[model samples]
Target: MRYLPIDNQLFVQNRQRLAPLLKSKSLVVVNANDIMPTNADGTMVFRQNNDLFYLTGVDQEETRLVLFPEHPDPKFREVLFLRETSELIEIWEGHKLTKAEAEQVTGIPQKQIYWTHQFEQIFGQMVFEAEFIYLNTNEHTRAGVEVQTRDARYIDAFRQKYPLHHLERLAPLMHYLRAIKQPQELPLIQTAIDITDKMFRRLLGFIKPGVWEYEIEAEMMHEFLRNRSRGAAYTPIIASGANACVLHYIDNSQQCQDGDVILLDIGAEYANYNADMTRSIPVNGRFTARQRAVYDAVLRVMKEATQMLRPGNLWDEYHREVGKVMESELIGLGLLDRTEVANQDPDAPLYKKYFMHGTSHFLGLDVHDVGNKYRRMEPGMVFTVEPGIYIREEKLGIRLENNVLITESGNIDLMANIPLEADEIEEMMN
Candidate 1:
């Protein structure tokens, strides 16, 4: 791994907390993500399964984590099955983890090194002993199909082998635990944000009338790589002008124009933790008065929404409150009439016509990080406060986002150093 090692205590505590949630005599299993293939001999870069990484801190492929808290043998309680490295693999792909190394990295004392071929025999032995199995799967609402994942294949095979055992979904428990960032995870996310801030500042001088959108993406990548990040946390949306209206716009091919605004929703990933940041700024040195009005309104709504992210606040209620805040901002921007809002459908508000997406989501491991929307805010919970107004007809989209960590007092803005105010942004650009 290019990134520095994360403290194993984070993973240890994560497993400790989750162990009680499992049924007695049950074993919890987590598999690393498949090193997905493209065409021919080509393959996409490997991304470790967030759940597997969360539990074991093992970032390699063909690795499996078995947590049998109720095992008769203490060594079997938490076993890490790794891809036993061979001389050939070392010559080609460099060294894979040794048993001692995996133990050190994960702080799980018991390690059973195995090849991919031995998985069935080893796993089958555990299945016969356990009454229930906690199988990990991607249950995130935003997850969409593209290719078959390792977890998906594991489920199909596991059911065929042990159809009688009660299979429980591990995603819900993982979503709950991973959503709440541990103290050790916070610094890694902060490092990502710091790198992202540096990249954004670099773009201020680099972005101008003639720069292509992809060039901006390249600039951010340069900064990320230099700062020890894997790269952009997600596909960067370097949308300029009308393209900003497309929420997931990532073509990044168009040339930025003088009067146009570029919506940049990008962040760097340090360790496995991520930072999701969005900033819309003028291509020129300054925002037009009209643009400034809408930008500031979105900024105001973002600031207010962040304040509501303290402990005990429900995620759904917080979003509803954010909608009202956005409704007011839209009304202030003349996009909504006060009377219209009063008469609008409760299910589909007038504000949706202009400001479409939700104001925030849990931010951490994944960009749209893992958290139940139904879950109440806790002090350790981290989220993104991103509220925007996109008017395709007007060819304008303004979004300002920052990472906020819930605290005892209220919440701390992790991206507090990143320039957000219109004056600060413009001054940085100039």
Candidate 2:
């Protein structure tokens, strides 16, 4: 792990909160993410499962966590199963976590920590004793599961072995627990945002006409790596010119012309927490009058949208209110007229023509972190306020984004120190 070690008390507190939520005589199992394969002999870098990491702070592969809080045997109440290391394996893959180290990192007693080889015997005994099984899987609403994960495979096998046990989805409980940020998690998230701030500031000086989009992306990667980030939270989108109008454009093949605007939707991940940010800047270090108009409109909408991220705000209602603000901005930008907006269908707003996509999404472990969209906003919930105007005909796209934390008083902008004003960006670049 490139990031520094986190205090294990966070994980200990997380487990303590989760244990009481499970059914009586229940056993919860969470598996680490598989080291994904690319080709015959190649594999992608391994990433720990968020739930497992949140619960145990264990960041290695082939690891499992078993929580049987109601077990008669106190030693088995909270167990950590790790892949046993050997001379050959250590030589090939470097050092894996030792038993004592795992115990220290996870706050579990050494007696409760076991090797992967002993998992079946121990888990089998616990399964027989428990009436309910809580299994973990990727249940994010936007998840597209093309490949089967390790946890998915385990779910299949566990069902076949213990069909009589009542199986429950652990995702709901996990999502509920993860939605509200713990006080300790704020520092980690703020660290990630600060890293992103550094990268964005660096790009202000690096971006110029005649530079390729991929080159700008390289600069971002360099900055993130030097600051202990695990590269981008997602694929870094460095779209220039008309490409910015395409929401997910990542080709990054075109050279930025003098009059073009580059849309950079990038972030840095630290300690498994993610920061999602988007900033659009001019290729020539200064926005043209027309570009400034669209940019300012997006910025206005972004500021107003951020203010609506207070506690008790409903996700759906908050978005609807933002849409009204965006509508007025689009009309001011001459993209939509009052008559057109008035005649537009209630189901499909006319503002979407210029301003598409949601104004905000939950930001945390995953880029688009999980939370109940229907639930009212609560203090400690973090969201990304990104508002944009994509004018394909004009070959211009402008977006301004910042991470905001909902508070009792209002919302606090995490990216408050980052430059957002047109003059500030231009001055930095100059």
Candidate 3:
């Protein structure tokens, strides 16, 4: 891990929260994400599974966590399995965690920690006693999963071997638990946001007419690495000019034109927690009349939408309210005909012509963190308030986003210190 070691108490508390939520006599199992392959004799960097990390604070490969809360034997109640380090493995991949180190990092007893090679034998001793076996898989609503995960393969084998154990989906329970941010988790996210803030301020001075988009991307990566961040939470969109209109444009190969506005949809990942932010700025450090107009409208809508992130608000209602706010702004921007908008089908709002995506989503470990959309907003839940206006005809797009934390008194803007106003950004750039 590039980041400093986190206090294991957070993971300990997370398991405490999960225990009461599981079925009686349940055995929950979680596996680390596979190190993806690039090509022959190559592999991509490994990212620890967010759910597993949330529960164990273990950030390594070939790891498994087994929680048998109601097991008769105390040692079998909770166990952690790790890949034992060999002389060759140590020479090639550096030192893996020792049994004592795993105990210190995860708050799990050293006696209960064992090597991965011993997993089947240990798990077999507890399997028949479990009334339910909760196995995990990638269940994020937006996840486009094609390749089979380690958990998926295990699920197949578990079913074939046991043939009678009642199986359950741990994803739903994990989603419910991971959605709300623990107190300690917030600081890590704020650190990522602070790093992003620093990077954005630096980019203000670096951006110019001739600078290519990839150069900007490289600078962002550099800033993230310098500040102990693993890298971007997701692929960055450094779209300039009309490219900004493409919601997910990541080609980043264009030259920033003098008059163009660069729509930066970026985030930094620190300690596996993420910060999502979007800021649109002029390449030449000054917005044009039309650019400022659209920018102000989007900013207005973002402000109005953020206030709705209070506790007890329904997700569907919140989006609907944001849509209404965006509607008035579109009319003010002269992009939508008032009469046409007023009569547009209720199912299809005309404001979507310019603002296509959802105004906000849960933000945490994953850029789009796991959460039940239908559930009401509550304290400890974090969201990103982003609104944009894409004018393809004028070749202009403007978006502004800030992370927010919902609290009992009200919601607080995590990015409030970061520049949002047109004049503020311009002054900083100059």
Better candidate number, 2 or 3, judged by lDDT: 3
lDDT of 3: 0.93
lDDT of 2 by residue, 1-430 (tens): 7898888899999999999899999999999999999999999999899999999999999999999999998988898999999999999999999999997899998888999899998887777889899999888989999999999999999889888999999999999889989998889999999999999999999999999999998999999999999899889889998999999998889999998999999999999999888999998999999999999999999988988899888999999999999999888978888997999998999988888799999988878988899889999999999999999999998888899998889989999999999999899989
Which residue pairs come into collision in candidate 2? none
Model 2, total clashes: 0
What C-alpha lDDT do the candidate models reach, one value each? 0.89, 0.92, 0.93
Backbone collision count in every prediction?
0, 0, 0
lDDT of 3 at 363: 92
lDDT tens per residue, model 3, 50-80: 8899999999999999999889999998899
Cα lDDT, model 3, residue 361: 94
lDDT (10s digit) by residue, model 1, range 1-430: 8888878898889899999988899998889998877999999999999898888899999999888888877767887788878899999999898888887789987445555667777766676789989988788899897777888898898888778989999999899888888889899889999999999999988999999999999999999999999898998999999999999898999999999999999999988788899999999988999999999999899989989989998988988899999999888888889998999899998899888889888888898898888777889988899999999888999999999999999999999999899999899888
Predictions ranked by lDDT, top down? Answer: 3, 2, 1
Lowest lDDT sum, 10 consecutive residues, model 1, at 110-119
RMSD for each model, in Å, please?
1.4, 0.9, 0.7
